[model samples]
Target: MSYLYLTILFPLIGFIILAAGRDRLSENVAAIIGVGAVGLSALTTLYAGLDFYQQGGMAYNQNLWTWFNVGGFAPQIGLHLDGLSLLMTGMVTGVGFLIHIFASWYMRGDEYGYARFFSYFNLFVASMLVLVLGDNLALLFLGWEGVGLCSYLLIGYYYVNPANGWAAIKAFTVTRVGDVFLLIALFLLYQQFGTLDTVYIVENAHVVLTDSNLAFWTALMLFLGAAGKSAQIPLQTWLADAMAGPTPVSALIHAATMVTAGVYLTSRTYTVFEMAPQVLQFISITGAVTLLVAGFAALVQTDIKRVLAYSTMSQLGYMFMAVGAEAYQAGLFHMLTHAFFKALLFLSSGAVIIACHHEQNIFKMGGLWKKIPFVFACFVVGGGALAALPFITVGYFSKDAILGAVYAHGQIANLPLYNCLYWTGVAGAFLTSIYTFRLIWLVFFGQEKTHAHPIKGVTYWGPLSILLVLSTGVGALLKAPVEKLLTSAQIPVFAIPESLEHAVHGAEHTAVGIALGGLVIGVILFAFAYNAVKTIANTGFGAGISHIWRTAFGFDALYNIVFVKPFLLLARLLGRDPVDGLWLLVPALVKGGHKFTSYRQTGLLREYASSIGLGVVVLLIVLIITQVGV
Candidate 1:
């Protein structure tokens, strides 16, 4: 009955109303419901948050009902909010509310899409809320799959476009592979711990699972699931293509909500990971590799959204590294900062796309700063943050914190992997600047290559302005508060490790030095990239490098050769479909046998009598043989 539970219910009701009333309600009314639902939920969260905080911010739990009861196992659908969950709730709902507002205006032009867009958007918010607030893993997975469904629905919202449709299926199918691993992990955890309750699992993981090998595999499976949802390596390719969705969808899902689900899951189950150091080591490596690859891909991307898409994957890689390195607080901090700035970038990109009449390629755009100077300026700030330009930007704090954790953890654990990650993080920062500035100058500074209609109104500028302010200042101001709130509960699961803290503490000067160094390197790359882009294709070296980056270092091609081609070749080898052929063969054999049997039954009654007498003699011979053998 608490408002905490109502946060999800409001959005669900909104989705149901908008969806069911799509035909009955007018566009404006439907739009209001869509935005209002999230807005109300945001309000509810604010109210609940204030009340909860005033009461010392303790954990709150509410059981709605027992989902089922079987023997001794019963995982109820419920809600739980501690400081961590509250923080996540604030991010999801607060950002979600703004996105809904922006989307209301963004989708206004699409005749029938207004109602449909909000419906899906609201449901997506509701699902993610359920994910972060769910009291048990079963309920969490429900929200998990819900977001996946909503993502597919939203990404392929432009179903008329074949490419969009393919991207949606790719996102859905690829994530399903991870989902399978997650389901298996859930089963394993249940087998080992005998409960799916979030609290119970974390509390009992160590007491229950003493087998180091079993723990390692379970954690690995969980990481695979996290990677799938979060778009990490091997499961990361779909994210870049997810740009096919509407811009609001990009900001909402890619930037703020669905992608972060994996991180939330990992944070909530830190104890499970705490027991498996080997798996954590693997997470660090996967994250480092994914970021480097995505950074490389971002450097050469032509489409604006794709660049942001790759940037997202790269940033996610950093979070994974943080959590893998057992810097849970650092990981969660980065997730928060990322949600603010990345969402800003995407929404700002939305405005630009609108001005350009749906043109997405930055190379095709030029000198838009003079036309929409506000958007141009916003991108600069957003770009600076994305590039992690020095101390002023929040990205520096969150990113540096993670980097420090990696170094400190590496040194403490005596694993050289963390050293490698620290360097990778630094390099990614530099490349991020190069590519981000490349996007900025290409679209806003160069000679006008394509004329764009100017964007003029508060609807476009309002959200961008608010986000710009938050992206710039949020991290610096919230640093101490975030650390305190997250570690306040002081449970071992959410606690910042002493080794990681000492490393971060010792490496303070190193972090500042790295930030400054990365900034300077980024600036140099920016100048070089900005100038080289003009004639890169004409020069041999430039052309080759450009081709490599343009191809996303051949990940797309790798998938084709490794997965797609083999699948097609298999289909060719069994053109009829092997299982389908088996079904056809059954009918064919029956017909052939019937034909053979029919021939034995001649039309003449004497033929029937001869066949019956022959059958009887054959049966007698078989019986005699059987008796002799026995």
Candidate 2:
């Protein structure tokens, strides 16, 4: 328990080591430090987890120091560990460690900034740890911004590419839109509750807050922040473009760490959301629409990583759907399973990209199954989990749990909209199967369109194989404790009457049928009707629909027209305005003065000595005049 801080310290230390050593450290040493740090953190998490269970699984708080005390408004530098944080910490370190291992191999030939890459990678993991482990909202916000900065650095790791830089900036700017909302929520909470301590806030919110208005606005603000980080709806365009970075960066950010922060935030502040049921319903609706939107977008993406990116958004939508229904355990469980399979899919795609000389368009890739049979197999398992293939995969269990919970909550609470959201989840699952298998078929089973180099190494296959194992039903063993821990901690759940309780199990079966039906249709469309599908896509209406979906239903265009264009126009109009000119003149004069003074800084010792002599002569003459006057 005392070693709780080490989970964050280990990676922070690794970041410093890699950053300071930079190119001086061999790739091998950097790999050891980068991967080993997360591995150690994972091991420490395991140790701490065992002790937590042994010691009765109560929440543990360690206050390192007081962060500040401004007129009695104080937040502490503290860490809190309970069932939720423990689960999040384990996933971050465990899945993150595997991603780091693959990154070492993926980045092998990157001679210029190999160490630099690991430094950013390690820092990202450390920041995520701080985010999940923080004791208060203030500390949580610190970690929140920490991951944001790290994401920017990692996404633009290939700074030589202008598009990559833009993608990174887009990510930073869009997520900041959410961060601003989160900051507002903090201010509103502090204003109402008179403290920024999270435990105190969550425990006493319903008790102290008399007005539902404060709760409603605060929860809504929190959801907006979560929506941005999770890439729901309008903020989602940046995620597809984020594929401009290396595939491992895509996996680490999209699959395991940064994107999931929003889900964690909403779940962490469940009490506040419970008080604002309207905002909760908004969360559920937002999730439903986002899943559908992102699923359609995923169907049209040709880049392998972009396909996975949209898929990540779609799956995150499911987690939000569950959380919005107050099914916290179910959402987190899906997140846990998603971390395993999504990382597997992304890493496998990275391997494929490496094998194919970095060709990413799936249409140009085919018959790679024989060349990289292992990667092909990896995709099958990971894709099965992603599609939530019934009964056999971890995703099926977790996703079915979400569908069940959403349905049960709706039925028990008599909310028609929640039931509608449940159907949306089912529809999202069908799309998941279609696009997932479409990716598998297009990339692996067709005629070989491109040559692929041999992929052979422990680094490449090791993490994939480990994640491959977790993508199976073996990982579903976590279901019991995950549900039990959250429920036992007094997390509120909708009570089901005896007569209506079967709806939960019924929803699970219906979801399975939909998944299987979608899988069969997916195989048929890609295998037997490929040309017909292509012809349809070439038709006017079909092409139009495909284009819209391909551009994520033109949300980007809408934003550009609605937000970007007007803002730019305003800037242009103000660029030479009379009032602006008055302010601009100040800087213009400062520049002119700088140019004049810079002329006197001649780089010569003789000129400098002559200037010193002249200054002394002037000073003596002034002093003599003053003495004569006296």
Candidate 3:
């Protein structure tokens, strides 16, 4: 429990130091505080993890104090350490430490925004920790909004760049749609169940949440919130544009930490989703569609970070698909595996960017494999892992398990829907292989497309190397251990069909053979013939195809026409004070009355008395006439 508090405290301390001393502290000291805080927290995370395992990964709720209370309701401010939170906290702190270390080198000599970067970076990690660790949805939402605000600040870290500011605003606006849905779900759950505690709500779901429509929409809203945070489907456009920030920002938010929050949200509240099968079914569909759409989008991206950004979205789709199919273990496993390799891709790309004089277009890079051999080796491991190459990479096992789950789940449904999801996932896998290798070949394969640029020692390359190792077979070794922990924590495993059991486990020779074949076919189709692919990529037809995908299937444009333009128009209409005319008549009448009364006053006491006497005489004459008529 003490270590749990320290996990949050260390990062907060780093944020304070960096923010308060942004100008006073030298870069070295600031870097130490920034990286050291999370580094120490990582060590503490391992300590907490060891204890959690020894305790059989049982759930522990640690409340620091009562945040507030009204009548009988008290939303405790606390940490909930269970199998899911334990793994998430460990991953966030560990991978975040590596990113911080990398940023220390990556952000060197920015006399202006150096400490400011670390400040936002530190707070970002701390906010995510609070998110996964909260005891109740209220605290969780606090953390959720915290990360969103920080994302806005960090994404627009270069406030001077109007484009960057717009990117940040886009992220905030889009995600807020989902956040509203989440808030509604939270209120509904509380009113129905009288509690915001996740454990309590899950336990009482069947008894208190019997209203079908309520449960369905609540679950749907939760999914929407997760989609916003995780950057799935309709809410996903902001993430790719977020690459306007620093590379480490891209790695930390898009690659590892922030984008995965949706998957975590769904998995954490599995029971709530279980109460609403319709919503859960839609979750699978969203996942399948997102994976396929983003996979194609990744293929056409020229910027290396944008490629990884879309890849992150696609990977998140796999997790959503798994959870949607009730494959909790599989979804969580893919999430963990994605954290390693995806971060590797972004971090490795950072080195290549710095080495190539900040050039991002892979078409502009060539023969860099020799100049930056370290980054080159790292990219192969990361790209291969992302493509889910057979036995050697971690993604093969995780992804195979998810696809098997989709197939099995579909078979149980006795419908084509799950079958569609299964094949869509497989197609995405193929597209993933093509785009990832396409990136590798175009960046590191032939003649140097651009001139060489120098890399700062191994300072940044070092973090890429660590993530690279994790992206390879080294991370695969953890799958079994994590899977065991997940099972013990009562996270249900998907029931694989007897015919496909070997595929999920990665144990059968035939399954291994198929994966290897896919890997070779992917390399052949996308990477082997570099010159031919390049020629087509530069041709008119190819340019048209790229244009379609480069606009992200016209989703951005569609949203602008659909949501953005209308909202802006409404804002403009409201800004003009359209109701002011309705209130103008009252003031106009009052002013006229005041002018008539002033005319009657005549500026002297005798004049005022004479007017009063004339009014009395007129009143008397009218009275006499009325009497005679009577």
Candidate 4:
């Protein structure tokens, strides 16, 4: 437990080393340092996790120092090791290390900024660790902003391309919208409670926030902040575009790090949400809507990474729905399974992209299943898990847990809204199945369209194979311990009423049928009915809808018209404003005066002497006039 800080320190040190040694370090050395740092962090998390649970999963606060003392609002720089943090730390480091190992293979020949890439990658892991492990809101926000900064850097890693740079900026700018809401939440929490300690805030929220409306507003602000980071609804446009980064960056951001931070935040502060039932309902509705939107968007995406990217948004919506339902354990459980399968899917897609000579459009490559059989198998398991194949995949268990809990919550509360949310989850699962398998079929089947290079080496297959197993039923075993841990912490959860148990079981079974049904339909449609799919996509009403879905229902364009254009127009307007011109006059006059004064200072010796004589005469005239009081 004492060595918990090492988890963050190792990665931080790795970032420093890689950053300092940028051009000096060989590829092997940089890869070793980068992968080894996260490996050490994962080991530390394992050791600390064992010790933590052995001591009965009690909340462990390791206070390192007092950050500041300000009029009784003193928050310590501390680490919090509770069930939630431990789970999150394990996921971030464990999945992150694997991604780093695979990245070494994926990014082998990049002589430009290889070490720099790993530096940003290492810092991303460390920042996420800080976010999950921090004991106070301020320290957590530091980690929060750190994650955001690294995302921007990595997303724009291929900076020679202007489009990638714009993608990075878009991601940074969009998420900051939520960050502001989060910052405001922090100030509100501090004002209301006099401290920003996470443990204290969660434990005492019910006591201090006696006004229901106050609790609702505070939680709403926090959710808004979370919604931004998690890429829900309006803030979601940045994530698909964020696929411009390296595939490993896509895996890291989508699977294990930045997107999950929002879910973690909402889950960590579950008590606050618990106090505001209305806010909780709002969260569920937002999540439900987001999942549907993202799922439909995924359906029309041609870029393989963008397909997975939208799937990530859709999956994150599930987590948000779980948290909003007061099913914290279920949400975290889904997050865990999602980390494995989504990472598998993204990294496998990376292999596909690599083998196809970086071709990203699924239609450009087919029948490569025979060419890269291992990668094909990877897609099968990963995509199957993503689609939640019944009884065989971890996603099935975790996702069902969420839907079951949501169903039970709705029935128990007798809320028609929650029941509708349960149906929304089912509909999302159906969409997930269709697009997931649609990707698999279009890329791996049909006439071979491109030559694929053979994929080999330990780094390539090792992580994928391991993640493959975890994406299966074997990974479902973790759910029990996770449930026990969170329940032990007394985090609020929705319980199914005994009377509604049968109905909940029915709901689960219905979801299973829907998932299977979607899979079968997707295979048939893409495999046998592809011409019809194509005809629909290229023609009338179907084409219009496809275009809308392709554009993520034009949220990007809508935001452009509503927000981006207006802001840019205003900026251009301000560019020539009279007020700005007024301020500009000072610099303009100063520059003019400098030009006038320097015009006579040419380097010719005769000109210099003439100027000096004229100056002397002028000085004598000025002195005579002053003396005569002119």
Candidate 5:
């Protein structure tokens, strides 16, 4: 088989092995199979990347079979390996392997579902690979729903907990809302183009529908699908609650693989988006608003995981902004860097939570820097990358690339919106830095406020060490290749003017300054506020803001009022009158039917026999009469 096939197949093999041997395999063996599958896939992806680089944009399609062939249309089961797929494949497998390894240790003593966890983890990786590598829209949809199913299973792995189950349902239901749009978009595409093949659809979409109006509507509808998958705007709330799952699940799905689906969709359909600049602008605005709203939500969160969850939402918003502005490379580069550090942060926090016996409330615990030095160091490195700390980190390079692209847009004399995007991006960066470090100081550096728990084992430290190295170095290493991949050979239509050169660079510097300043101020403010709150609690005056922040800005309450309450009220009204009245009528209908049927039957057996005999005689006489008449 080709490397492309191997890249997608190994994870399936791993999933099968773990699942079939769930009761027999040792945890160590299962971990190896789980992590090894993704690791091998990652290596295959690297080989594919190198091969693609040498060949200079070759598309590899491996057809397994015809999925469907009917009525002048054919959709096949196949995998497509190209620059875009190669990029996503590498990120998914590489990060997925790390998460699997981390989970091996994280789930060690859980005992109840040890084998099951690896099975789900491997399957999740396989589904994600299928998503990235699928050659046609139908295959892609299969991967789409596959990942959604895996997400629900993994999110509610602790199924005994009602809250985790509910969280899983919420995630599945919310994403389904988006998936509906995606399915509709796909059907519409097939209807218009008569083909589900990526290349064919992209190449012939314009010809299939010559009207610009139709093209715009089609593109806009597809983007709605992307928005839901990418967690942009109104659909974004579920990502925060998704932290109810294990930390590694949070890192893998939220940080690396699943949430980036929308980005991939948009990138793959660049031709479609290019046709609809209005849709593109709408995407940018939605991204900007999500960034701001999620950032505020992050600022108020207390649980360590919830903080990271909101951070993921905010960062995803920045990525969407990059896509909206047509800075595909910048968006993807940030995606790459964000994957490394965010995974590291989440994994490191997992170690902390494990060490603290599952205490996620940062206010209850502090001074962990000394207890878990390696984890603390990893957190700092990850946090520094997240805060875009100067020259040394991956986040700096990628984030600066995005800001630079947005600034370049501002140089277009006629486009005032680019300037707005630039400013919005800058503000996003500053807020990101502030909330990120606030998490850092509150969790790792303050006075120890909770009881101490000792942590054990070499497994915990191993995965974290690997991630730390990547988070620090991958940015500079991938910079040139990423820049080339994103930008076309031809010069861009937009240009940054010399007059605005100072302003652009100055804005970047200002953003950096704000980032650092936010970090410093956040640390000081958290320390002071935490200390004062503790003192006030000792004096009984600390309940107000604490209660508000813990309630998550009342978004849940609003949802309850607007969605839950109204639906429940409607159900109640229907149950009381309309449904009950129908049930009452059902009994009368049953009685009337029974009474009508009684007239056809006789009480005595002889009478029933006579009725049957007379009916037979009448039928025969009628048959004879009809034959004579004919």
Candidate 6:
């Protein structure tokens, strides 16, 4: 019963209590139990993290039991905490608790509120804990699927709506496609390394994968899994549609816990990534492309949460780029900061929506800054952090670290085509700022487009306030330690360019200038466009562009046509028809055999008895003859 186990177990205990007592307990009590469990888990994680830090990055493992032993292979159910898991556990519990608390308020009025909502929320926390704490690949998969199930449950928490249920199914099915590759990659790792333990696999990767190509393919498959979970490239569309869930669930799944699991997996398996540099390059390119695509999509979105959803996808792309560049700590740092601000932004947006009587379209919201001052302030801080507004914000520090990593890779490591990645990342930063501020201006600073309703209670403001503070400070607190931890492995160092240094400071200000330039242009353009298109007739001029943006550059359509349709058709042709034919043949043969057997039956009972007796006599004579011959 070490603190590590307690940190994970507390949430499970809460989940059980809330789930079992759902019918009996009131919504308020259920909320308390759910939030209280996660709050306690957060405290336990903090204590465990402090102990780990005091011990200076040493690894701690607590074995609960032998999970399985067969054919000379044994896997244990255990918890492993190091710098990586410590960071993740803190994020999961801390941010997860806030989301649960927020959900308590957001889901207050719905029927079956306590039973339906908290059950999924608590289960989500428990699944995320298992994901970060598992010591071996098999156990990791269990957590992985657990989180997927919880995600499906939470996304479709309002199952009365068929659309929400469909959205949940879409998410589950898409991610599961990636999960298959993940399972294959794990089996391949075990086949090669003879073990699925993270440490053992990393240490013996060289022995098992003597060929670089094998390692490259294995790592690539694993990255495919990461891509799906992190919502990169072909698998990214589900994240945008995931806005159908409750706002807090969206924040938890998209911003903080489940989405970042892919990047964390890559970081945890850094040595494997190191061995497969080609795979790393592929990851970088995929991330860059996803960033640009999602950024454009975000730019055109009117729904506040959909904008944030696309932003999450874009930010995740940046994270994947960092991981691919071997900037593990930089990526994790961005994740930490992004979690704070993104959650803040969503919760604040939720407040605004609730204040507006559940309206989510930004076009229908304006001049809300006066009505909900606290929420407005929270949005500004969170939005500022997201736009990477100068040195005072968390986004500034974390995003700078990521770009610095890429700059180091290009200038010092002499990695081929690294400069291209560096420039793409810079462009993404600018686009990120533009789209972020566009949402801000449309919702908060614009002309009054809709009448405002008076907001009630501190429930809306409480979570927003807590997150705003964290959004501003988490980066500065963790920056130095993360840097040290990432670089302590004696890996080859990448140097930052002098120009990039100037960019880091204010001396040579091209990057900042570009970012600000994009923001200003986007603000002016969006304001004019939104104002001009106040009526339906004015929107016709850009109808084509609007369609293209709304369709997400037809990526989903292309995937449906190229992959989904063909596979389904082939399944119907080869899988269904042939299998059904075989089944038909078996039944037909059985019918024919029964038809033939019917001829042996006699109408009279005496005839059947005489036949049976004759057959027995014949059998006995044949047996005697066979026995004598033998």
Q: List the residue pairs that clash in candidate 6.
A: none
Candidate 6's C-alpha runs over 4 A off are: 206-208, 447-449, 484-508, 528-541, 566-578, 581-630
Model 4 alpha-carbon miss at residue 272, Å: 0.8
What does candidate 3's lDDT look like per residue over 1-630, in tens digits?
566888989999999989999888888898899999999889988998888778877787788999999988899989998888888898899889989999999889875578888999999999999999998999999989988988998888878889999999999988998899899989888888888998888677878878889999889989999999988888888989999888889889966578888888898888889999999899999998998899989988989899999999899999999999999999998888888888888888988888888899988999998898888888899888888877788887788778878777877777678878887887888778778877898899878988877676566877887888888878989888888777765677777677766544443233345545666765786666656777997999998888988888999999989988998999998896769966887998999999999888768999888888999999999999999999
Worst ten in a row by lDDT for model 4: 486-495
Each candidate structure's TM-score, on Cα atoms with residue i matched to residue i, is 0.90, 0.91, 0.91, 0.92, 0.87, 0.88
Q: How close to the true structure is residue 550 of candidate 5, measured as C-alpha lDDT? A: 49
Off by over 4 Å in 5: 205-209, 451-458, 485-502, 528-553, 571-630
Clashes of each: 0, 0, 0, 0, 0, 0
Query: Tens digits of per-residue lDDT for model 5 on 522-544?
Result: 76667667676466645534556
Which is the leading candidate under lDDT? 4
lDDT of each: 0.85, 0.90, 0.86, 0.92, 0.79, 0.81
Q: How much is the lDDT of residue 551 in candidate 3?
A: 82
lDDT of 4 by residue, 281-329 (tens): 9999999999999999999998999999999999899999998888888
Off by over 4 Å in 2: 493-495, 576-580, 583-630
What would the TM-score be for candidate 2 when compared with the true structure?
A: 0.91
lDDT of 2 by residue, 1-630 (tens): 988999999999999999999989988999999999999999999999899889887989999989988998889889999888998999999999999999999999794599899999999999999999999998999999999999899888889989889989999999999999999999999998898878788899788766888889999998998888899876777888888888899999987899999999999889889889999899989999999999999998999999999999999999999888888878888999999999999999999999999899999999999999999999999999998887789999988888888898888788999889999999999999999999999999889898998899898899999999999999898888876666645555545568866767888899989988998999899999989999999999999999999999998899999999999999988877879678998999999999988998989999999999999999999999999999
What tens-digit string does per-residue lDDT give for candidate 1 at 458-478? 666777777888788565687
The CA root-mean-square deviation of candidate 2, after full C-alpha superposition on the true structure, stands at 9.5
lDDT of 1: 0.85
Error of 2 at 106 (Å): 0.7
